[model samples]
Target: MGRMGDATRTVPCDAVAVSSIIETTGLVMEFPSTRALDGLDLRVSPGVTGLVGANGAGKTTLISLALGLLKPTSGGISVLGLDPSADGPQLRAMIGYGPERNVFPDDMVAYDYVRHFAQIRGLPRDEARSRASDSLYLVGLGEERFRALGTMSTGQRQRVKLAQAIAADPRLIVLDEPTDGLDPVQRDEMLAIIVDVNRKFGIDVMLSSHVLEEVERICDNVIALDAGRLVAQGSLDELAGALGGVDVEIVEVADRRDSIDLVAQRLVAGGWTVARRDPGLTVTGENDEEVFDAVVRAVADSGARIGRLGRRRRTLDDVFTNERGDSSDRPSTARTGGTE
Candidate 1:
């Protein structure tokens, strides 16, 4: 009876506090041939969190579990203080999920489809209609809201999905590849809309995207998954600190071509590793202060003056690509478009 209640209850015994919107403990998911997730533990705070991973890295699997669309083979998941598997319907009511695929019904009008979703989420017919119209306009589809879905371009259809997702006024919006298949301008517009959704409405967002640049630009924190395991999770600064201790950039040498070797030798002599760049050299150290001191010492010893010297920050690409694992599925998500 106790076990039955555990399986049936909508709320987790250890409820999520204000600090975290989502938490998973020792999460595991196994298929017949492959383990989609392995002992994954994750915590998500408010604001925009980016879910990043190479294809087939179990990013989609994690998303599915969070939505309670797939029961985990082992582990527990809590969203908004509710057990996803046990209280899936209740949990999903507060979560707006936009899938990567284009599964919209072609014949229906955009506004009607969004309104239909709002109603399905338990809104009254009148309120759903009102919210749907407002959401479509908010997503920049107001002028075309009455148009048939089939008549819209890929970018427009993507906005329709966003409109429907927000129609119910959910607390958390989970967007998978929201910018996929969009042109540069469309992508920028979509990213802006995503930012506005969180800031303007006070909704938490989990963006699952392959574009590292966009994620870096919009996300407050990032979770990196690889081969069914969580390899990294933190604010961008924390992840960068863990991966790259400190990178000192030396620029504007008297003669870059000839000074590169001299600078590298000087830094190496100072017990620091140095990598050459076209316009500068990147020196590694234990921390910023230590790196700066070393850079000063190295420059003094080498008698080389630099126009600019500063600590360089690492990018998402640097963090993702430098991770050590069997990333055979790097392109798997690209091929599947994370549809599953």
Candidate 2:
């Protein structure tokens, strides 16, 4: 069954969290075959914010536009109180970026790369060298600081990119797919570094990823997208709770989901809709004794075997799929407004 009552009563899973940093309006970017980004709008705050989407969904495009690397055909994007289109260099100087792809001077040692960045930031030669070493250590590069970057592994190369970005001590860091190629241990190490970058250095980070679970674990808030459009944006709990509530359906069937059509009809009588039929059907809304009893009577009357029946807690992934998937046949559960 879909839900017991109106899919409007939201269950509070946790407290709320909010922060505001980057903001956009009527954001649009176009290309030859497809509109890379539509009339998109987003609000990104400080702390560790997760920017998530599938490939070609405009996650990369949005970051490029926001950082001044690319301009929107029409729309406004701002970072750290500056417009990237006009003050690209100035804004970038105050913001650091680590791209999804690895780019570095293969011939240069890690020390030289970071030292060069520190020098470009106007530090004296000696201080630049010191800062470079400090950055190397911060990312767990010890004696390998003098090793040529081209000779390094993918993980090591990424660390170099991070080191150079921080050498300038920018207040804001934008990481595009930061954990792209690392294994479990390496990924965890990188995650730890990212957290330390925010907590210890007091820098605000905007990280983009397709790894939904990673985003949930590390982010304070999320701006999720699908096919280049913003579908849902907020703290994890807030977004998931908006799905209202979730419940598992128990049907009497040697095959639990076989006779859902009959049960669906009975559920419709009680103002419930059948959301899905899998291990069991998923119904929306709450703990309704009446609905449970109704389901029992229907199943017993139909001579269906009584299988497992329970409620499943909604998760961030569930909320993401439900919101970003097709909406033509579905009803929205109320939401706050966003910029055009």
Candidate 3:
């Protein structure tokens, strides 16, 4: 197979032309017994955004509506400045999507599969062939382009899915669980390709995944949903900084419990809100510097040495836990139709 040339490196025109990639207003999708999305209002800027939610949180439903696969029960949605329901064909021509499931023809070779989708997107036969080769190369499957998908490993098959999604040079791509089923190294490689797709091609990306760490790693913004409702949306820094505090760990001593208790008492006396965490305590204050000073004073007064003390930077996992509470036991009522 021929390698991708400079002529085939064209980027989508709409990548820079559009400001908001996706927008929804009062969107609702109801099934027979459960409502998938409830009055969701969202506006996503042009960047790599992570769509986060638990099982049956209407993530799949929202993606379907955005891609014009499913009409909303009520309200409106816009993609690339076009109404998805009204201009689905035109809109889809400018966008690409990779669903969570493995839906591939066993007998089809990688190049043919991607080229077929490129032609379906209206590319000429020659351009489609060039694009298919280029996309496979982009996903690190160039050498395997002629291999039957059935003969490929799970990681290679996933790369083929990604190659097809980008074959037409779409302005935006929606990926659900792009890193699923891959081992650590494969997952890292897939994530790097995703970042390259957005950074190098300027294609906006909306990634939906159960792995918050991967989301945190690759996304510029995040949209969190819960029980079919919009819970949070913002940049990683914004969401993490909202829950700022200090974590203080006491030096382990024969009487470590007593030392921790002493420090906690002193901090509480200093008007700090203290919470017990294993091996130490978490303290919050109106001012961070003041909190740090108080912690120092408390340790000094208690005569307990400090093991570790630092401002706690909250992770995406922490943000999710704090926002969603203990909803782990809540049964999923929303119908995802085989997607999460």
Q: Judging by TM-score against the true structure, name the best candidate.
A: 3
**Over 4 Å off in model 3, which ranges?**
1-12, 249-257, 262-273, 284-310, 329-340
Q: Looking at model 1, which ten-residue stretch has the lowest summed lDDT? A: 331-340
> For every model shown, what is its TM-score relative to the native structure?
0.78, 0.71, 0.82
Clashes per model (N, Cα, C within 3 A): 1, 7, 0
Residues 116-200 of candidate 1: C-alpha lDDT, one tens digit per residue? 9998776879999999999999999998999999889989989999999888888888999898888777888988999999999
- Candidate 3 C-alpha lDDT tens digits along 134-171: 99999999899999988988889889989888888888
**Which wins on TM-score, candidate 1 or candidate 3?**
3
| Model 2 misplacement above 4 A | 1-19, 241-313, 326-340
The candidate 2 region of ten consecutive residues with least summed lDDT is 9-18
Better by TM-score, candidate 2 or 1? 1
Q: What RMSD does each model have against the real structure? A: 6.2, 13.2, 6.3
Ranking by TM-score: 3, 1, 2
Q: Which residue pairs show backbone clashes in model 2?
A: 1-273, 2-273, 2-274, 2-284, 21-45, 26-340, 252-305
Backbone clashes (count) for model 1: 1
Q: Which pairs clash in model 3?
A: none
User: Which residue pairs clash in candidate 1?
Assistant: 55-333
**What TM value does model 1 have?**
0.78
